[model samples]
Target: MPGPLLRPLPILFLTRPEAASARFAEQCGDSGLRFDTVISPLFRIEATGPLPDASAAGGLIFTSANGVAVWLAQGGRRDLPVYTVGDATARAAEAAGMRAHSAGGAADDLIDWLIAHTPDLPLMHLHGRHTRGDVAERLTKAGLTCGSAVIYDQPAQPLSAEARAALLGTTPVIVPVFSPRTGELLAQERAQAPLLVAAMSEAVVNALGPLHKRDLKVAARPESEAMREVVSDLLKRALAGDY
Candidate 1:
């Protein structure tokens, strides 16, 4: 006789924006994986000001979709050189009329790209106030003149009482952290459960700090799609079990 399907695994999702949760749900699907999300948005996305003038920026950098969306909403020139840290941001930049040049899918990689296939123009990094890595500083330290604007702040949102209880209860939980802030939150809360933590790169995994490694299995890929792709495979396993 076949074994009883395990109850849907209880997974925790970290999200601040409503949109983020919706996508997470779609990603999880109706697999035997029950989702318990904490609306702990390590930051918020908001328009800081008018879209910058490309004539003044010379070139631009974007690492987050919020940066791309806000700039697109404000309408910048479609002809400027746009550099991005990840593929999604590049796609968003393209949607915003920016002819984007990718930086190898990571902040650090982008810096390397700058050093290699370099652009001969003054650069402006359009980003969130809470930048994850040392890209801008690395560029400037390398003697590159890069301007910047804190277009938004990715502030953390605290978990609610219900979410806390659900998380504290039993079940394997997977957290796919796209940013260090999300990983830091998981590290700080160290709930007693098997954690499958995924990030976008080795740096992002390191950025999670000691709290993450204390009691979790961690995996970091190189892109948002890659992170989601890993989680998708887990859901497929769940479906096969008929849980």
Candidate 2:
């Protein structure tokens, strides 16, 4: 007699804006991680305010691809060297005709990289309204000239009906939270269904508060690849009846 086969758990990527969620979904598909994905963004990325002039900056800092997109849209200069928090942002900057260097991942890592490499450059950080870590402040305190400008805003949005249904459904839901703000938002929703969270860092997990203690898995590094690996492990566990 053959027992029933276990179904793959559904992955619910509650990331910001449509673009980021779509990118994650694409990555999941490309990784051959067999699972249904529901991309319901919980925030909208809107360009707010004008972009600052970067002609005088020795280098530029970007924490998110959203910042790169907004800066490019607002006619930012591409001649200056660009330093990014992760690979994605670095790619975005390069795509926009700028020389970009990736700091591996996380704002703290970016700060460290800047300190070590561009210690004397006048850097300007272009970021969203909601940002983690004080990149500019920390750099300035470290005797490096650093400034920041808000190029975009990620306004909070409610989850879609499909997302809500998926979250509360019988199938296990796997979520990868990239930022503390997004983690906090997911915590507020507090879906009672079975959930496995893949947080980018300890900060993100902390933002989720105490309710998701048991099911939360923090990535080894605060990078998309690390988070994806965590999600892949969770999916494997789910298919093996260990989730």
Candidate 3:
């Protein structure tokens, strides 16, 4: 007798900004995962205002690549040292010719690192308006002089038609929620399919509240790499009909 046939893997729904989703999809490809992906950004990254003058700051801080892009677009200089919350943001800063340092993790990791290193006084953090961690405040409380500015905004956007269709279909859908805001946005969506979620942190899962899902998994660490691993595990379980 022939062996049982394998079922198709669930579709992966990526709901970050356009550039960010593309980057994650690219990383998934690099990891040799051939699962289908639908990139439907739920937020649009827009510059809030002109970047604050940084001539007097000892160094620059970036918690997201959006901040780096906005700062670069506004003719911001790259001479000052840059400290970032994660490797990806640090890479973005370095690509712009800035001296970049990565805390290799979340905002809390960056704050702790800054508290230990105690870089030049009055570091300037350029970030979006809807950020969670009070990085600048925490650093300052830790005795490191750090100031911050809101340079970008991540306003919500409706899901694309294709995304809606995917969510409405019977096929399984795997969603990797990177931020609590994204999770909240997803909670408002109506999904008929068997939904599996890979949340980046406890906050992301908490944001889902009472949303119905077939399964949920939180990353071991609040980082992109950890999320990727969580996503992979979800995919494997989904294909095996473990959900």
Candidate 4:
């Protein structure tokens, strides 16, 4: 079967590694949306260590694939209730043979869910060094201790020569910016033009800062599905000479 290129405007993704590119291809293909990717990884994932005690907490939480990987590597529990911030993370948890529970699409939403679901239960949140959310604080307020176990750190990398060329030389690509850091890097490179930013939510939009937001087209949902939907919508709008 052929891929999705039904829309006049081709989608582009701004990410450093081939992972983002590959994902854009699959999602677009499934949705009948044509997309090309740019390598601008923005950050690299680095693993450190597991928790000192490593006892099972009241629940488990994941915000990224790296977090899931690290938790699994550390012999983390596979039976605890897993609260994930993104669909990608949820999928990762499931792939690791764990039961996954989604709490909306972002950390804040997950925190809200935790607040409502188990207000008094202790929880351990697995995340990156630079991850967002104040679930711990909120949980503390509710007389619950939320321990954050940082398994890895993310360091922002730069764009490759090919990526720079694609952003400058070609017409434009639909870059899916999932986090504030990725958005920040892109915002630093171009003041305007030659790229489209598909932000996941209002938080992501603001994370990119005002300058980036001025040029970005946002997604309806903060999930992977919503991000794909925005890619299709933006392509249609771009083809129609409206955006």
Candidate 5:
């Protein structure tokens, strides 16, 4: 007596940079959710090297892990006090032997932390090409005497063939978007399958705009672990056909 077979879980589409998306896929594996993953980076992170001399700067700011990696690659000094947007970036900075503090949220949170704690004057924000929030500008307005440097560039990249196929197929697809820029790029594409999205923040969700998503979930926090939890929840919902 042969019984009916169950359908496979939805594809987990990751669209961060190559390394970042791969790391997230690994995290999903570690969390016991082995859904098939497609790593199609929406942005290629290239280091804009020859970092500016920060001999006069007293503090450092990193809004993304990519910035931290580029900084380490460029032999940027780590002696300055470092503030980061999320725990992941702080952890990356710490791994590089820097004294780093996490705002535990987004750029606004980092700015608030700087305003409250008032770190050393003439702070420098090391970031990527496509960035928002104007961290250094806002900080300087708040009387923090902050400056910024473009350390890397995240130019737009086309989704992989596999990603495009998954999006156009009948099988379900689950996408966990980490940044607004990723969301913006994804919004430009069309999906035929049932698409579920797990966004890292309100900004990400907003950037997703008018995508015809079957289900959408926002992480409770801006950290990577929070996004993972949201994805896990979406997986359960997808399996149950709750979307």
Candidate 6:
């Protein structure tokens, strides 16, 4: 007699923009996790105004990869030290020839690092329009003399038809949300399919606003590695017939 057959894990619905989604897919592959996936971005990053003058600034702050992309495209100076909120953004900055340092993750962590380092010189934060924490303001209040420039705009987008159909299916869908903004957008979609949310942080889980109560898990840390671990663990539990 053969052992009991195992059930396939739920499909993953990736809501990050094209580039980021591709990176996540690559990570899943590298981790040896296989699952059907749908790429549906809820926001589009668009370059905005001219790059701000950073010639006199002490260093640069980047909270998102989009901001780093915009700054690089605008031909900003790459010699200055680049402070980032996560490893991905730091990698982007380094690829553009900048000396980059990651604060692990989260704006508060970045602010704390800046305070401890005491760069003292004026720091310019290159960011998108839909940013959550005011890194510049927080740093300034701490006597760091930080300023910000909106170099990109994250225009809202909607779920694709394929995404909607997948979300309505009986099979559970694992949605990994990286930001509070993304979580809010997912909540508004009101997907009725069985869902297991992998939120990057507690703030992201809270941003879901009571969507599905029983199927949400927050990452151990506000980092991509932690998010991936949460996703992998949830997939294992789901395959084992454990909710």
Report every candidate's CA lDDT: 0.65, 0.81, 0.86, 0.69, 0.88, 0.85
Cα-based lDDT at residue 91, candidate 5? 95
Which candidate has the top score in lDDT?
5
Instruction: Give lDDT: candidate 5, residue 123.
Output: 89
Q: In model 5, which runs have C-alpha deviations exceeding 4 angstroms?
A: none
The C-alpha TM-scores of every prediction are 0.79, 0.92, 0.92, 0.84, 0.96, 0.93
lDDT of 4 by residue, 1-243 (tens): 998765444446557346755766676678655555555577887777655354747677787777887788878778776888877888889998888888766777787777777645568877787867766666677666777777887777877776766666534566777777666666677534445668877766776765432246777778778887877777655555454
Best TM-score among the predictions, by candidate number: 5
TM-score, candidate 6, is 0.93
For model 3, how does the per-residue alpha-carbon lDDT over 83-105 read when each residue is reduced to its tens digit? 99888788888888899999887
Candidates, ranked, lDDT: 5, 3, 6, 2, 4, 1
Residue pair clashes in candidate 5: none
Count the clashes in each prediction.
8, 0, 0, 7, 0, 0
Could you tell which candidate, 3 or 6, scores higher by TM-score?
6
Measured over all alpha carbons after superposition, the RMSD of each candidate to the real structure, in angstroms, is: 3.9, 2.0, 2.2, 4.7, 1.3, 2.1
Model 6 pairs whose backbones collide: none
Clashes of 5: 0
Give the least accurate 10-residue stretch of model 1, judged by summed lDDT.
Answer: 212-221
Evaluate residue 40 in candidate 3 and report its C-alpha lDDT on the 0 to 100 scale.
Answer: 96
Pairing residues by index, what is the TM-score of model 4? 0.84
Q: Name the TM-score of candidate 2.
A: 0.92
